[model samples]
Target chain A: MKATNLSTPKFCSALQILGLALMVFWFAAPVLQAAETLKLSARLVWGTNRDKSADDELKAMTPKLKSKFVNIFKWKEYYEISKKTFQFPKHEGKQIRMSKNCEIIMKLLDKDTLQVQVIGEDQLQRTVKHPLKPILTDGDLFVVGGDDKDSYGDAWFLVITHPNLGKEHKKEE
Target chain B: MNEKLVIQIQAYLDGELSAEARLQLLARLEKDSEARELCDSLKAEQSLLKDVGEKDHELPVAHSYFWKAISDEILPHPSPRNQTRHKQTAGAFQRWSAWLVPGGVIACIALVVFQKGLLDDVLDGIKSTGKKAARRAPSFHEIDSQQQNAGFISFRSESEGVSVVWISNY
Candidate 1:
């Protein structure tokens, strides 16, 4: 009786087919996600556009600033720097010192809003509420700035948001 | 032809039997041709093993050439000095390659940061003076309920490339 060799052509072909199927599944899985869901992100940026452009004028309406584009408080950047700088269970008085003797006082107003008070070296204090929108869509920019008029400003709070940008666009509240 | 006699003959050749058992085996060997043949075979095998183990014994072929062919096929031997040099080069390469991981991570971070700076420049350039109405109105539901409760309203305009959010109470 002839013994059968385990490395037969049919067995190898079956293994190759299985391996090919796994590769196909691995590559195709992410593409099969339901295209209906919308993804969004929001950022609260506090910077002086220091530029003389009218848009910077509108965005940076604060008066008496030192340098342009001085990012005093950015929501994402601040929190990241703060969490790393401070210990756990952060308190109200937990402050992050910015450029030109500007100190940022953080307070959680609500689940969706954070109150940041930017006090400049000149003792000019500007308080702005940064709202954390739960749902963000594409191309949505939310800007919250201080009432700065001249090229020099104390601080500006900007929030960029993107909302309900989905393929279906079936209005989701 | 008896199996017991055959065993006894082998035991006698090996000197494992007592004197009385040896004498019995000798008598049986005289009577049994099969027992005698078995004893002769065992003796011949013992002598053959001795001859093979003896240093003066000659092989059918040259031993050095025979073993060298087998060693070449099993393992190709390189010069020890060259092997040491190759290993040192490989080790140096491995040590250098170890730095590549952190280097790659830093490079990726720098690229992202550089790209972000470029994007910020472009966005800043695009943000000029404009107060035109937004091309698309923000969906009412897109407004967060928390912001509404706080008297805050968010208005986004991509054309303006700026989002204007304000508090009504202020």
Candidate 2:
């Protein structure tokens, strides 16, 4: 027996619906672009470099740090402690809170550079224009006690900015 | 005569009437000239039908062959050229469909692969993460918390656009 003509309209209607959906998606794609971001990790270590002269305070914190190193301080070495990870805005500028009464204002200078301004606990501020290199740049800031002596320790910073870090971090979780 | 009486006459001629009905019908035929005429006409009609039906006439075949006969009668002539053309069209359609089914499927898969930008995304992810993983182990910055204080101004990943800054005595 010859087949009747029945499926033509249904097939055409399906095509029309798909075409309409494509048109809608094409028009709305740009407005749905995802927000871009960056991840930053700051590690503060209070320890005498094995090569440097041992300070009294660093010598005291060394044994305690080594005892709690693996659990509390995953990174090795004496007097090396504390780590903070934060996300920064990719498109504009914002002051990221680091600790009590201390915040760093960061401005995205471009795709590869950042204008970083650090405000210390004493209300003193310093700014550094740094590139997003994988290597470390030291002496970004120095924290001195109330006594203010040559015994004051200097801090070094290593900053890495990668586009996939946030995504990789999220994938790990 | 009325339709009911005519029907009764037909039934009687067919020998379908009961004995009581036959008696009542015979009485009606005796008293009514119209009823008698109808009965005679019906009887003559039935006899003529029987004579005509029995005289060397062919009996009709059952209706089981009716649709087949109608189909043969109305169908177009089976021209060899037309048959070959139909077969060729069907064969071409089958061959094309054999290729087109898988071809269409492969085309759809290719479109989906490209549409989602899967290859580029994967390559870019590997490239960026690979760069990071290939880099050297990070050097540790040691500060004496008791002798000197440490403060974070800001830390940011330029590519990722994230940062953290904090001040710590230790």
Top candidate when judged by TM-score against the true structure: 2
DockQ of 2: 0.03
Give each model's whole-structure lDDT: 0.46, 0.50
Give the TM-scores of the predictions, in the order they appear: 0.26, 0.33
lDDT of candidate 1 over A140-168, digit per residue (tens): 34445443333244334434334333222
Under CAPRI classification, how is model 2 graded? incorrect
Which sections of candidate 1 miss by over 4 Å? A1-173, B1-3, B14-20, B27-82, B113-170
Off by over 4 Å in 2: A1-9, A36-40, A45-47, A50-82, A88-90, A99-102, A106-153, A158-173, B1-121, B124-170
The DockQ-derived docking category for candidate 1 is incorrect
Best by DockQ: 1
How well is each residue in B1-170 modelled by candidate 2, as lDDT tens digits? Answer: 78898888888888999999999999999999998987887778878888775457788976858766776777777699987987787777666656655665565556555655566546645765665553322222222222334453333333332333434432
